[model samples]
Target: MRCDGGKPACQQCVRAKKSDGCEYDDGKGKTRTQIMREHIARLESRIKELESPEITTPPITLFDPHAASPYFSESSSSSSHDSPGTTISLSASASPAPFPIGATADLESAHWDGQWSSMHDFPAVPQIGEPFGAEDPPLELAQMLLEIFLPHRHQCGLELHVGRLRESLTHPLSEQRHPVLMNAIYLWACFLSRPGQLYEHEGLYLSRALAAVNDAIANPAKAVDFIQASCLLSVYFLSNGRLLEGSYHASAAASLALQWGLHQIGRDDFVGSMSSERESTFRLEPAKDSIEQGERILAFWQVFNLDRCWSVALQRPATIPDSKHPWTAITTPWPQRMEDYETGEVDIGPGSPTIHAFFIHQAQVSNAIGGFSTFALHAKAAALLEGASRLSSSWSPQLSTSPSLTDNFRAFEHTITRFTTSLLPLHQLSATMPEDKYSLILIHSLAHASMIRLHEPFLDDQVSRDVALRAARSVTVVAKHIADGDFDYLDPLIGHCWVCAARVLISELAQLQTTWPPANTVDIRGELSTLLFSMNKLSSRFPLLAYQATKVQKLLDAN
Candidate 1:
């Protein structure tokens, strides 16, 4: 038979030969080749039918709600910034978690493999009965308590607990009487009070923490103690969202560390009685020591400098003027100074430092609020970040060759690059706000970063893996902390951490599913659901955030 496409079937050949259509002579069956030919012919006709341009489906419009909403809309703008006088209203109808008081602790234990870990776990707690008092609390313990207790105040509503935490800072704590612990408590109090509408309370705790650190610095014997105390306080400040305060503290800590080194030199000179040969050797010692001390001081400042820069970048106003702002003018450059090991000539790291990693984080926050301006900030940050990454390799040799040093430099470079490239598209979103709009800007940025990890040219590089893992872990740490609500006072940035954790978790899940398949997909959805629920709970504080929460819920549900 002739087909519609003008192809003749084998059956016509059989008929013309005066034989049966069936190729097989066996009783009731056609030969395999004959049956295959017919099947092939049917498939070819079906393929043609499918190949023809589809006409029945409606034309997709740029304005279609389903297709267009993700990319454009006005609702996203409102969620970005919290209005000046907005008060968070908690609905009586909202379901309260069982045992909310200890929820933060429980969540933390679950997240960290029940290690009771805290922010200060980096330098492990000193051995008991070795110099420092065995009973005296470790700085890590203080950090843990702050992280665990702070978020619990949210259960009492933002306004009430913010006041209460502020009040707690004034009362003297006799239990764990180390200067560091007290300062940490003060910092936590400041962090919790600042985020909402209470600026006065925030200042009080910050001032108190600073005072304690200053007092410790004045006493020579207590210098090391105070420096560590101050470092912890500053880190807490930065982590808690008191970026300006955090930056100040970080800078102060850097300066103090330098001063302490100088004081040590003075003490050494005062104590030494110089013989002719010893004096000759010692003359060179001061210069050599000064050089080494300077390098070490710069390295020390590098850590907090990054933190300050990141905080400033994140808090940078969404709007940009024709000319750069003064703060941006002074601080936007990367690696403030690059020290030459041999000659001590300082080269600056980069111009227009990439704020991509930082911006990606802010984008997540903006996405949670549905803020287009915030999203745009992220895009700008990403662009700068990209520029910074390109310039990063030039300073690679300036970084110490120590394994730890090299790894950190590589990680920093990789993180900025990956984060910036992923956020470039978010800049393209039109400036608009919609009613009842919510967007997972954080998740989207993270997803973009994760996509880069799975498919990009940098996948094989160790730095990429390190950056991706660190980013993921940072998110996880923030999420786990927020979920547990363990800190005594809540920082405004706690929500930022939650968003970070969610983004990272989702990114990791996506990566695992793609690369590891059946092995990693298990429990993935459950973990995602838990993170989404946490984001939703946190977002309920602001109406804009509530809308964002709803958006996240839908996104998670669809996924």
Candidate 2:
């Protein structure tokens, strides 16, 4: 017998006179060319799969703005001001009137299509000096340095900071040795302290902060410090609109604080504990004033949960008041805690006082605004902040000077500006729907937008218009980021805020198209409607959005 390659077969096989070739010489091995061809075919298949259109659920398209309608119709009349046909010139010649009074008219005239490359102008990154002498300066100082040194570090800085924090957490400093430093580190990780450049970075910072706090907790000596750190981090998360994370941290911090009796510690010795036994054994003497302060911070974080589900008609499975698990108590008022404060005792009242105040104020405003929950929330938030300012000055002198305080105030101011700006558009929408229904929708949109815009201002009119136009285009973008499955990178609560803002924007854009002159009515309205439909589909989860999408659907159906 011979092998396939012409080599002699094994002697035993040859003796047997087997016709089949030896196993070793069967010639089953593939050539290099064949292997490469198979690889290329697999790669090509993969590329085609990547290039294929994603099989998404088709968007609902029930509205057609091009259909003929009587000018007297409610929808047509209400949106008259937005008609592209009625162009409102923004030139000096068009409106010679002075500043604030003519601001609206001026804004209208300046409006082009508002489409421009966003890369044209970006803010300069800030640079801060490194701290003197410390190998690992307090995290707070490090963050402050980052903010000061590279304020506009944007997404890059966020990534770097998260990396550094994660590394530090792996080898935490001795908890008993550096209370102040640890506190600073925890504060740095807080999401609110982060520069609001991109949503992704904010998420990274939040995750890192939570991880750091958890690491601290694992070390007994650092447990108390971790509590304070966690509480601050929770506040930061809530401020930045990461409600789920904020709630998680807030709940953890509040529980730990109660267990450790943090509110009982005297101002002078609060940061000195190291041993778990000693820390656990110490009982706080009730100090009503301090208790109120702690409560306020807690209350603020708690309100985020409520705000997250604000737009839903039916309560979500994860809503705040569901009794599946126990929740922290609502914070009590300051005046009620006066007895503990005057005596310098650790009263540490029922719950988070500051957050409670926020909710109370929100509820009051909601009741008064005739169901304009958003408006009432903002009005109340402003009031709560103003009240906080007064309380901080009286109860905690140092807090009044704290940079964190200043940051919070700035955030509050931004919130007010956003809410105030939304009033005009909301009022315009209210004219179309039933008074009560529209009022509720308008308030919700106003409050939600105001809250979000507080941090990221659209200072430039053109930029604002562009953002508004994008918002009008489709709710899909909003839904993808907000209501779509768990995107750990986004603050779920803040996502809701964005959804509300986008809804308002779409409504305003539609109104603008209708109110403009008849010259470009057909084209402009068509474009605006397409944009609006896209936005509507995206925000379909938030059915209570300011504009009556069902009305648009009916209009589409009629056509």
**TM-score of every model?**
0.29, 0.29
lDDT of 2 by residue, 255-295 (tens): 65545444222222222333233443534334235433433
Question: Please, what is the whole-model Cα lDDT of each candidate in the order they appear?
Answer: 0.35, 0.34
lDDT (0-100) at residue 127 of candidate 1? 18
- Give RMSD to native, each candidate: 29.9, 29.2
RMSD of 1: 29.9
